[model samples]
Target: MTLQPKNMLNRLLKSLLVSFVCIIVLSIIINLTAIKLPILTEASYERYLILFLYLIVMIFYVSLLFDQLYLSQKAKGISLFFYLFIMTGSLQLLESLVAQINVQPKAIVDVIVYTLVITSFTVLIFRYYGKGAESYTKRIKNYFSHQHISKWLLKCIYAIFLLFIAHYLINSMLTPFIEPYYNGRYTNILKMSHHAGDVKYVSMLTHALVMVVGFQPLFALWKGSKTSLLFWFGFPLFIILAFQPFIFNVHWPLGFRFPLFIEETLIMYIHAIILVHLFYVPDETHKEEELVKSKLSLSNW
Candidate 1:
């Protein structure tokens, strides 16, 4: 359903406020209940990643809840964007939790249990509360047919996610190859001795750029009303903020400056776009007679 241009901005304001409050509450709860737990409170990198994951979940929850309540178009799109993340994250979280409890390394039973649990939760959320109806889903599918350029851009965007996967896999494989170099030592901060020469500033730049590009589609979904603007202006804005530092500062490359910037920019844009899109884009499809009139169904209202 098309939104009236007049009240669109006002609706977006309300959606943003609601999303902010929800995020705050969720953040507090996560910090209070989960952060203090024995597994999480430890100073492990895995624990830190899990904390970040929880924050990401809270962001998606706010976005999805706003879409469900307000039938926001942008929120719906962002919700779709978050579905992929939530599914993948649920898998990781389940595995991590099971391993923590069992005190085993890559236990098959733990893996299976975690996989099933994550899959079930993801399926339930999508089946019951997913935004946009069947018709809108169809429209999104149809969008792929006509928008070859966008589809290509999406592929380019996905290449970044693939790079991360590659990094993870390569890091694992290289551990065996380079074990002799460090003698399989556990350093407080992981140092790159084998790939010391390979890991240059350019590699760091590539990593940063790939990360930002990875979520461009979600940014696209966020800026649905201004898709062209997002592609043209918003993207540049993000690139400048996320990448400019690495271009300038070359000292202490080991610190998380680049990665943190990428993630921060991602979350900010995600929240902003989710807020604006939620109330501005209504139910995806309008009935034959509904478009002729101003009012939507009582169920929608």
Candidate 2:
């Protein structure tokens, strides 16, 4: 799908507006309930605002990626809900893990409440937009038909596994050096598997698998355009931006902070760019289909 500059700009603006509105409404509700959310409570207003802006951009990019998939309107709407649900769920799960280590009652309560809120919204939104349970299932089946799932797409599953292994190894080595400097305060990587015997490896594996699988649709959508200069540049930038949230969470010493930020950002970006270029390629089936259609038209003439 061709992304028009004008249309992309409009979508970006709309995403930003929508995100700002949603966060404001959610913050109001949280305030009224007097529930303490992690960053919302402890973080400065400027920091929160920066996160909101980043979230707006992230959502916009994700929506653009979703649009490229060419799903039905109903399906697209459901996809957004699914995205929000999964993203929030994952963050809350991480927060829960941290709470387990620090024993924060409020953080635990926030996770429960946040899960309920997201789950309720997801159910309500899906019910409103969905035709019926059977129809919904059928819609999903239709979307994931033979045309979309080709050999190239299947290959991404293996690539994702390998990427996760790389991420695990890199994180394992780098985190120890960083954790000591921060005194185990900012880095969740260090805390995730702290005392949890097999739990650490399991959690790391689970998170990597979930993220890779969750992002497969986008990977499949973009696979055909892997060679585009736009993809080459934008993909790495996107990876860097993805790590901003994590970097911002870390409480680094002033001298070490900027360098660490640059270092992690570069590492994540390089890792993603290299992996995508190495493994993801255009689907042969799709190329064949286009060639067949072209030939058929020429023969008719």
lDDT leader: 2
**TM-score, predicted candidate 1 vs. hidden true structure:** 0.33
Task: Compare the candidates by TM-score and give the number of the best one.
Answer: 2
Candidate 2: pairs in clash: none
TM-score of each: 0.33, 0.60
Tell me the tens digit of each residue's lDDT in model 2 across 1-301: 4668996777777766655665665577677987765547554777668657765665566555554555556655656555554455553354234222333546556655644443343333223332322344544444355455665466556656665566556655555444454455645433444465465455555655555566445444443455452464344344323354354454435444444444445434554564555444355645665567669989999
Summarize candidate 1's per-residue lDDT along 181-240 as a digit string, tens digits.
Answer: 333342422343544434432343355343444444333333133333233333433433
Residue 48 local lDDT, model 2: 67
- Measured by TM-score, how close is model 2 to the native structure? 0.60
The parts of candidate 2 lying over 4 Å away from their true place are 1-5, 34-36, 42-44, 91-161, 182-197, 219-224, 227-241, 246-301
| lDDT (C-alpha, whole model) for all candidates | 0.37, 0.51
Residue 183 lDDT in model 2?
56
Which residue pairs clash in candidate 1? 72-278, 73-281, 74-277
Shift in Å, residue 236, candidate 2? 9.6
